[model samples]
Target: MSDCDDRALIEAAQKDPLAFGALYERYVDRIYNYIFHRVGNVYDAEDLTSRTFFRALSHLADYQDQGYPFSAWLYRIAHNLVANWHRDRSRRPVIALDEIVARSLSEQHPEVVTEARATMRLLREIIRTLDPVRQELLVLKFAEGLSNAEIGKILGRSEGAIKSLYHRTLLQLREEMEKRERGER
Candidate 1:
């Protein structure tokens, strides 16, 4: 559904709780994927996804249309919950590159599959070493496929800031990957 459709659903849901089910159906998978990528475990992702929707449903009355998609609000809620989850556990974020790699790999060649998995594992490790903001940027950009503007809204930054951060993040990832290659040698 388009953002306009989501806005209308939000307005309707604000009036009747049953209407919120449609909104939840529309976004549940995307929100789950976002949370899953951030937390890297199915159980925590499922728990957090439930909490995110529950919070959104409870706060639906206060939702305002600020020209951003309803998903942005949902994402903001998910982001906060994930942050708190990490803070409480004192654990670093772990992007599940295995799923991502598996999806992208062709099963035609055993050697290629092994190489791709190894590369993805290395990338995942490097991503975990990045600070939270950069890791969030990567997840929002690649994992969620959100545009810079949407990410900016979720992160509370300008679009230009998101662009700059994305650029620097790519550079940093490249440098880290290079360092890993050198160390392996």
Candidate 2:
């Protein structure tokens, strides 16, 4: 864990409101990225991102260290908020695969980017098809580049259990990608 612990900051914030801004500044980017990946829209991402911090600030008194970093606790709040958003909407987000493909192609070459974009688009689509828990697990493991142990803290699972789930989730994603390819061919 880094020396700059957010739990301590949160505790301090509970005593003084101004201290909370430090925590917000520290995590705004990460939280925004996390929310953006889940929601796939900058506008909704911004709103949810703000809401995450707002909710966290309100519940700051309830936060406990529990060995995990303060960022993990904040992530839990963001994760729950995303889940609730999905449930309330009752509609899966429509990821803009074309935009991703176009941006990749423009940055590289159509020939070079085409296959990669297709794979990424398929991957994103397949991820959405999985259960919410699986989806969150994959996003945190892959997109956020979190270690299994770190993920365990965020999701409140054993590190070993997280490793197992990570492996299984990767296998499932690979199978889904392969199936998509086979169908295309």
For candidate 2, the TM-score is 0.88
Candidate with top TM-score is 1
lDDT string, candidate 2, 1-185, tens digits: 36357656777899988899998998898888788878888888999999999998898877776777888988988998898888899889756657856774787867778878777778889988887777777778766788888888888899999888878988988898888888952
TM-score of each candidate? 0.92, 0.88
Model 2 residue runs over 4 Å out of place are: 1-4, 97-107
Candidate 1 segments exceeding 4 Å error: 103-106
- Quote the positional error of residue 15 for candidate 1 in Å: 1.0
Estimate, for each residue in 31-87, the C-alpha lDDT of model 1 and write its tens digit: 998899889988999999999999999999998888777888999899999999999
